[model samples]
Target: MAGLPSTARVVIIGGGVVGTSSLYHLCKAGWTDCLLLEKNELTSGSTWHAAGNVPTFSSSWSLMNMQRYSTELYRGLAEAVDYPMNYHVTGSLRLAHTKERMQEFQRARGMGRYQGMDIDVVGLEEIKRRYPFIETHDLKGALYDPSDGDIDPAQLTQALAKG
Candidate 1:
């Protein structure tokens, strides 16, 4: 790698997922003279050990959209580049043990539905059927999203840096 440039139109201070993604988007938006400064190697920080769970369910519309876009970008980047992100779409299940939690799940489901997410409120029987490992005796219900999953943060960060 070459030394850092003396001048840049934009300078990013970190090389984690967020910083690298910001650089990538800026470059994509026609800011090729941008530079990223990292005291250590990229993804060596918290990004390297992240769970990398990408869930599209959120109460806020903007956050949901950003997550959806990020998921789509990761999927496309994995296919477009040689890097393997280890991305998975295994989905996520949020269990509710009380009536209040179930109500919260209901609100989340409504919000997800409004934002075009495929979320569902499942009963205890369905939860048991889907997740046989879960003990649903004290559970009221659960929220299930088919688009939620995990990825390898290290690989993802490297991929973004490469982009």
Candidate 2:
């Protein structure tokens, strides 16, 4: 800690995903006099246990937009920083077991379409085709979001800190 700066325009409290991301964004916006302090190593807290899923399927328009933004950001973050985030572009599926559930998925698909998302209400056959190991007999269909994916939480934190 001897070489640490004594003054900063902004001080972030932790080194987890949110904190590191905040610091990174601040620097990106030309706020370079920012410092981040952590009690332990980066991602030593709840961020270590996070699933790090980037899902874009949402019923709310605002939430869907946010999710979409997050997905897009994560997709390009690793390349921007020249760090490997282990981000996977594997799509997601919300299984619909009954007609009511299928109806709900249809509504969500329509909403996604309006937002220019690549979402579809796929039948059981399509689900099985995409994922052969899944048991789809009881499922009427699924709400599929091709943009949904996941990332390594620790790697993401490191990348943000590097930025």
TM-score of each: 0.89, 0.84
| Best model number under lDDT | 2
lDDT of each residue in 3-117, candidate 1, tens digit only:
8688889999989999999998998898889989888999888898888889887767788889878877987897676776788889888988899988878888887787677
Off by over 4 Å in 2: 1-9
Give the Cα RMSD of candidate 1.
Answer: 2.0
The lDDT per prediction is 0.86, 0.89
Candidate 1 overall Cα lDDT vs. reference? 0.86
The TM-score of candidate 2 is 0.84
Tens-digit per-residue lDDT, 1-163, candidate 2: 7988999999999899999989988988999798899998999999999998989988788998888888888888988999988989899889998999899888888888988888999987899999999998788999989998888999999998887
